[model samples]
Target: MTARPILLAAALLLGACSDAPSPHDLSEEAEYFEVSDNSNNTVPVAISLRPIKLDLEIPRHHLASIAHPYKPWAKTIWDRVNLQVLLPDFQFRNTQNLAEFNSQDSADVLRYRIGGLSSDQSFVLLSVNKEYQEVDDFADVHLRAYVNRRKYGNQSEESIQARQPTMFVVNESYLRTPSEKPIVLSCNLRRCNASMVIPASNWPEADRVDFGGTQGVRIEFNYDQKYLRQWQQIHNFVLATIASYIHYPESVL
Candidate 1:
């Protein structure tokens, strides 16, 4: 998404982050490369500094699981995710996520060089909350866990990369506020959608963002078709079991 026409003021804060590095920071070393037609550099000069790579520092965030709400799943996800997912913590695997993306004098941009191009990889940058929402549904004791990548400390090593999109969302209530409408539990069927069960008490009651109060979110948790269908079952089961907490508004998202 272009990030224009942001309805919420909180979303505006995301605008502060830079898009990429400047041209001067690019590598000065001699290297033969082909320049894209778009680049202003002459064919030879551009080729000298070919590749036209860019290094982006994706800010981290967290996503709650909506698939499994059990013990070991919850605890294990909490402790181990820091290795791959980012949390609101300050130390980013030794500040590596930010450090590797050079924007100052030496490096300018980052562009992935896939070994073979079936199709230049395409990606979707989703706004964390614009698509789905959460609510209390005491049905099936659904598993929910947060992918805490948007936080501070959780960033992978430069060489290592995430196998999936770094964000996840499920529809218990599609609206920002509670309503008596059916929330669609559907997702692209063929992704991994793991869920967890988080306790209300464990939530930071003081911070609204932690419990869906005022915090603005910026992350995506991706799931495969199998996981998506699994979540659908769990979501329906929860709604049928706890008709009180969930309101399945019959509307399309």
Candidate 2:
């Protein structure tokens, strides 16, 4: 009942004052690493329309002789069509499909509460032989998408790697801005590919996307196999929307 008792009492009081973790926090709850922040309760919309600068060295004689369609018009159409028409259409179609799919699913396999869409333009450099002569007019944009879900708690590293969440990429044609109908060269560096692990689940934070300057719609959905399978349906719906715009060039242009 000397210094030891006094010290113990002080320690007990300090411990009582410390904040304890909530039950939910202690449980194996999934972490939400935001790709897009819900700004003021409004759906986040990011549109990046950087001026298309062609750093080409075409000869003055060739430019005058060859009837190359005005380069400005290409950028003009790309910006106008994507922002004004195509993007909104895709957004609407995707939103509708998401709502319909999520509503029917009993597993709650989607998590895009702060819903949003983004479209951007940027030049991707390619290194091919000078003789290759690939028309590098169109921009190449790579789209990779992922969502988060809780693992079954205490998963081994190997299991988590094997169970990694599937990252989806929008189909290639959608990447094509409304340009020449008969595409001279493929606009994409690679074909539009979706992750094999459908509805990719249990992804590490390293795979989290930077929604900043991101183009295209990002959907956060559940990782359940039954629910994840529906993603293909959404992808097809988006593809169809883009196809319509592509087919009816006049509508978009």
Candidate 3:
């Protein structure tokens, strides 16, 4: 009677919940390194983003005690180990925006959440500059890009903007805000023009060496083919991971 229908309704609701992709669900199935708490919330050990969907598998760094340099089984099991992204080398430069270090408790500095977006329709990334000596030897590099709206659905736009924090990679010359005794990363001192914006497609192919940029309000940065390839890969990987991690920390990593 009425009781029977009530039980059936409950069953249907349970089925619906089971069918939907949970936030903890990942697009792929592989060796999963899960970290969860009593709340049962688990952050993904890796993340993927963009057209390339770069894999962001973390390797457990606890193995530092092992004297063995290489182990096949260890390589297979822990090759791409899972560890927290300690301090991101990339961020945005807007407000008091020119932050230059990896320290906590700095609200002005962008938080290292898995997914952060911007009003300019761009995503921020952390990378390295091997070509330019100014940033090459520097610990990390920040890359910013506006995401094409058509790609991500409209319904997700609000979350994408508000939740996704804008990342900044500031010039080292800025005043170092001393929080927890924060220090700016010192790089090889070399003079380079910051006025020009070098298009990635027009970059020349070369070894690990960074080029100069135009100095102005709208500055341009360019990377030759060698560095371009790496930039593209890392960019895609970090972005994709951010997208997924922000949405579902448990599933992506």
Candidate 4:
């Protein structure tokens, strides 16, 4: 009887282990490409399901570029990077009214990349059907709400005062083009947030923009605050550069 019980317990343990989630082998399903620019700089591109939930070990070759290199590892910079195409479920006519948009069936193109020294630079460009005016309105509404929350929300006075300096405000000058409508400016003692994007930050601001007109691509990037004044130029360059990498059926342009 004791031997039989032990065997049954061993079988149950093995069964549980078998049922556990293992790394789904997607290596064969992954699409591979060589992304090259006009200047002939090339990098390997692979669109594959994330291998694991943990950080990945960075190869020694890539670590050499870091200024103050330490125990280097890699992790998903953006969770949304894996979403090659934004399906109907993810589309938003206006972020302000998410419930209404969530009910509609629409699709959008999205492309992203991790680049620059030690893979420090990254951006996600999304192409939606919405017009430039709608995008501007979305940003304007959000900016006002963000400011109001900081100024009048239930946060403690000390907390509000601490964040006051880094808070963003509209730059009247750059509000020339519809593309520039979303741009705002903010400065602390150390640096300023000067991008035509929302949700400001300090070191590497997570900036965003709706590149209006025929191609309604929304671009989001991480950049140093010092490059805020050249936001327009950066927008154009990222669009053009990323456009080169995307081929026919998958192109977001």
Report, for every candidate in turn, its global Cα lDDT versus the true structure. 0.24, 0.25, 0.24, 0.27
TM-score, prediction 4 = 0.28
The true-versus-predicted C-alpha distance at residue 126 of model 4, in Å, is 24
Q: TM-score for every candidate vs. truth?
A: 0.20, 0.21, 0.17, 0.28
Q: Write one digit per residue (lDDT tens) for candidate 2, span 1-253.
A: 0111000000111122134444333323222211122332233222221222111221111111111111131122112111101111223213234443335432332222111322322222322232122221222333322322334679775664443323333334654323211111111222222211111112223322422233332222223333333444534443343333232112122
Collision count for each candidate, in order: 55, 9, 37, 1
Residue 166, model 3: lDDT of 16
Model 4 CA deviation exceeding 4 Å by range: 1-219
Give the per-residue Cα lDDT of candidate 1 at 97: 49
Cα error, residue 233 of model 2, in Å, equals: 7.4
Candidate 2 wrong stretches, greater than 4 Å: 1-155, 168-237, 242-249
Candidate 4 lDDT by residue in tens digits, 88-158: 22231233333432333311322223221111111122222221111122233223112212345577967
Better of 1 and 3 by TM-score: 1
Q: Per-residue lDDT for 153 in model 3?
A: 46
Please write out the lDDT profile of model 3 over residues 108-164, one tens digit for every residue.
222222211111111122222211112122224332211122324455756543322
Which wins on TM-score, candidate 2 or candidate 3?
2
Instruction: Give each prediction's root-mean-square deviation over alpha carbons.
Output: 23.6, 24.6, 23.1, 22.6
Weakest lDDT window of 10 consecutive positions for candidate 3: 3-12
After best superposition, candidate 2 residue 60: deviation in angstroms? 53
Q: After superposition, how far is residue 172 of candidate 2 from its true place, in Å?
A: 6.9
Candidate number that wins on lDDT, 3 or 4:
4
Off by over 4 Å in 1: 3-160, 170-226, 244-253
Query: Could you tell me the TM-score of candidate 1?
Result: 0.20
Candidate ranking under TM-score, highest first, comes to 4, 2, 1, 3
